[model samples]
Target: MCTYATVQTTLEGSAKGPEGSWFAVTDATVYFDHPVHALAEHTLNIDFADPAKGPGARVAVELTAAAARDLLSAIQEALDSAPAELTA
Candidate 1:
């Protein structure tokens, strides 16, 4: 079953896309749905994009549920271990 829930937010960052090129990412779109390329039936999908640049200026990732949870944990750990001043 698809949750059909999506979360989008504005972000200021850079993401490497095709051809080993980097682009400024101004938005993030996260959703859980059927994978476009992954073999899994359903996966967590994240898209970092710069809408002003066009649809091609984007980096996408699709991860299995387990992997997504692991990534979440790793992100939290990395943030937790960082210096408060740097993170703040």
Candidate 2:
């Protein structure tokens, strides 16, 4: 079943999009739903985008639940291991 649960946030970062090019990512849209390309019936989808640059300036990721949880743990670990001054 599709959760249809979505969340959006403004972020300051860069993500590599099409053609091995990089773009400023200003927003993140995260959702759990059917994936457009992933073989999984449903996935945790994340779209990093720079809306001002148009639709092409975006990077999308779809991960299985287990993978998503692992990613979350990895992110927390990386952040936690960083110097407080740098992370802050």
Candidate achieving the largest lDDT: 2
The TM-score of predicted model 1 comes to: 0.93
Question: Please, what are the lDDT tens digits per residue for candidate 1 over residues 1-88?
Answer: 7889899999988999978999899999999999899999999999999999888988999999999999999999999999999998
Sum up the clashes in candidate 1.
0
lDDT of each: 0.94, 0.95
Error of 2 at 59 (Å): 0.3
Q: Using Cα atoms with residue i matched to residue i, what is each candidate's TM-score against the true structure?
A: 0.93, 0.94
Show where candidate 2 strays beyond 4 Å.
Answer: none
For candidate 2, the per-residue lDDT at 39 reads 98
Q: So what's the TM-score on candidate 2?
A: 0.94
